[model samples]
Target: MLRAQRAARPTAVRIDGIVKSFGGACAADGISFEIERGTIHALLGGNGSGKSTTIKILAGVYQADAGAIEVAGVRHDARTFSPRQAWDAGLRFVHQQQTTFADLTIAENLAIGHRFETSAGGRVRWRAQHRRAQQVLDQFGIDADPRDELAHCGIATQTMVAIARALQGVEQGDERVLVLDEPTAPLPPGEVRLLLAALRRFSRDGQTILYVTHRLGEVVEIADQATVLRDGSVVGRLDEGEIDHDRLVELIMGKRVQAVLSQHTRARRGDVLLECDDVVGGPVRGASLSVSAGEVVAVAGLLGSGRSSLLRLVAGDLRREAGAIRLAGQPVDFSGPRHATDAGVAYSPEDRLASAAFLDLSVRDNIGIASVGDYFRRGILNHRAERRDARRLLSEFWVKAASTEVPLSTMSGGNQQKALLVRWLRLHPRLLLLDEPTQGVDVGARAEIWQLVRNAVDAGAAALVVLSDFEELVEVCDRVVVLSAGRTVAELDCDGLSDGVLEHAVLSAERAAA
Candidate 1:
């Protein structure tokens, strides 16, 4: 009953020593792996570890400089392979970033995946498409209204929608390969559970899944096998029975490493740094909270508890149906994010890689993006000043990179996040908003980022940090705000903040509200 001996079904994909280089630098270095039919295989790596390169090659975005890719035993000429070919041959990739139309309904996004409707008729008849979409969505336990905009929903729900869209091709018994690149990055724990369970059920239905993710915990919980990558090379493969968290970490970093969760000293006494009064958004009740200067304020809440949405309201990223914000006792109205910026607010968005990076730009340019006002003058270029400052930030933030001039997209995700931190910190803003600040960031990088946040607070900046990782909030924040269904329910100081207490409060508050 060994895997290789069972009736000899063709593999979903076989990546054979694929290599890719950009600008004379090796992006993927001789990587190889095989994903079998109807199995959930994970590609585990930190950012810049060639995960992106390998997936891109499989998706036909890159022509590998060496090696070959085989889909269902059919070898692809790396130089000639294209995404259209991959799709025509029954492979689909759902990116971490939003690929669906923002203004379009969920049904429309799914309609694009309905292979049978490739009519030459110049019009897309969506009535039939919705029915088709519903049939597929029904299989995955998605019951959301199809008329809702894909972008309007939270990242977790949209991700489910994305999965639903991708599976349209698979449910037809086309021998499809579904590659999900960090699909759970934006999901809360509950949604994550749903996704994992759904994926497991899908595998039973005979779909081959190649999942790429950074969260090691998720790998342990769901993946049957994991392939580790580092600096464009395949370091090792952990079969279903072989991988554990510690072993996986060792392989992922390409060296033995320790998990260093950040712990910090709280700022006990401080002046009022930021305050919001009577803030209102849909599903968010009249909410009010404050963060002190020289201190970190943590916002903890259950899924759909309005933690992220509240932070979004305060940061000017999301519109407030109504509210008043005060910074240093001055009245302010946030017309939008730029208005918040003018008021000296810098926010690191929850979705770091998708929202924060300039993919085609160099590391220097991305880090230097927020500092342009101070660095540039009279519309004249200052190359030396920019390079000098960029290099300084990279060193200070401990951003791992081959060189500062390297393309931002080529760096590991943790490094990309570090660059974002440097970019925001360079502004020296009065109040900082960090949503899931260290998400997808490694243990070492996470610790360093915490220290950096402390340094910022020590320099007298107030911060409102929203994180789903309860441990992170406990370590860094001076005050805790627990929200339930878009309203601030309970506010606790550091004295009573433990995982159990916080969890209870958030849970109780949610239950009572419900």
Candidate 2:
């Protein structure tokens, strides 16, 4: 009956004929979709398919070239819609980045962008503000104290607080719409569950949520309705009964993609190319692993379980406190990343935007920066040779960019990642240390990246990868190493591995450690 009643509710938002373009690229080509009131409506698409552009237009970050947006049955010009107007109309957005300050109290974080409680004499009412924050926290099932610092709370709790802040003063009404843009992208497996539960609870309380995410599993779990976009046009819409993992992927990819299975026969494992004998550094508490030539070994763990730190330690980005690292049977200690690179090792960090990518530079520069010496002749840089090599690498890697001269930031997340891979592959490294190599890429791009890695491994290279998604781990890796509390707990072959089996191993190990 609740579902039936929700289905009968009026449309919370209706986007009609929305069109946005960027330098001949049609980002939102006559996009149209209707979000039902008090339902969790999902907007999904591949990277660069214009999901972000449409949301930005609705959020007033970008003005649509032509279209109309109807909120609560009243139509408004998309071109004239501003952020202030969107806020006034009860449309709120919670982005993927951590927007809330960890140093501030929960009450103070809530008070931002909203009028603080004050007396007529202009004195701030701290007690009243705390009381209101407590009420909001209680409404969201958050267990943290309102006066406590936000950093004291867990990641999921912090995200819930951000949602609570956006939803302040929003009641069970028709005008309210909360947009969550990849809210779980940065969260771990456990935290993602908590946030998804909170979202379901919010929808139950008549909160209209427009959720945007690439994780189809989350969509299957929470979304009552979903709209799929491809190449800036609406391709398909799925109702509650029709939303499934395979169906959603079909709509997103415009083809029936096979399940990510380890069907491709791997090359025979060669000699151990890289070995960490009880390696200790950063959060890695005596963790040990090994990767052989023609093999891909995956490090599987929850957040802060030393998955990334282990990779960094191997790449010489982190100082090794103890233990031995053997590269092709040589006991060598690298002082820094340059030493590791010089030793034919490539490492890609987890946070690509901050550590790996050069967003301000052109695609050509970003790709060729690592190998600039090869294009130098007698201390003079050869610009023509550099451009030629960059264009060849871009074409070889299947990177979709307008031109080599375009800024790297102008490319989609997937293309940027591909370009980064091209940079590393050009080095012809013997061992690849990749931390979440396909972190923010789409499904099609993810397949291409795996192919690229396979091509490298087939050519006498080895890869050690850290994957948060167990499904991806089982799909791409020949073996999985489980980490718990910065320790290697268990290892399993990927012959018949399932996410359930992998997760069970992780949880059991964590429980034993506890």
Using Cα atoms with residue i matched to residue i, what is each candidate's TM-score against the true structure?
Answer: 0.83, 0.95
lDDT of 2: 0.88
lDDT tens per residue, model 1, 219-320:
877777889888789888887677688888888776666433234556855788788887888667777888888888888886677777877787777877
lDDT of 2 by residue, 80-121 (tens): 889987887789999988789899999999999466899999
How far residue 211's Cα lies from its native spot in candidate 1, in Å, is 1.0
Deviation in angstroms for 50 in model 1? 0.4
RMSD for all candidates, in order, please.
4.4, 2.1
How many clashes does each candidate structure show, in the order listed? 3, 0
Model 2 alpha-carbon miss at residue 164, Å? 1.0
Model 2 TM-score is: 0.95
Instruction: List candidate 2 segments past 4 Å from native.
Output: 1-6, 113-127
lDDT of 2 at 427: 95
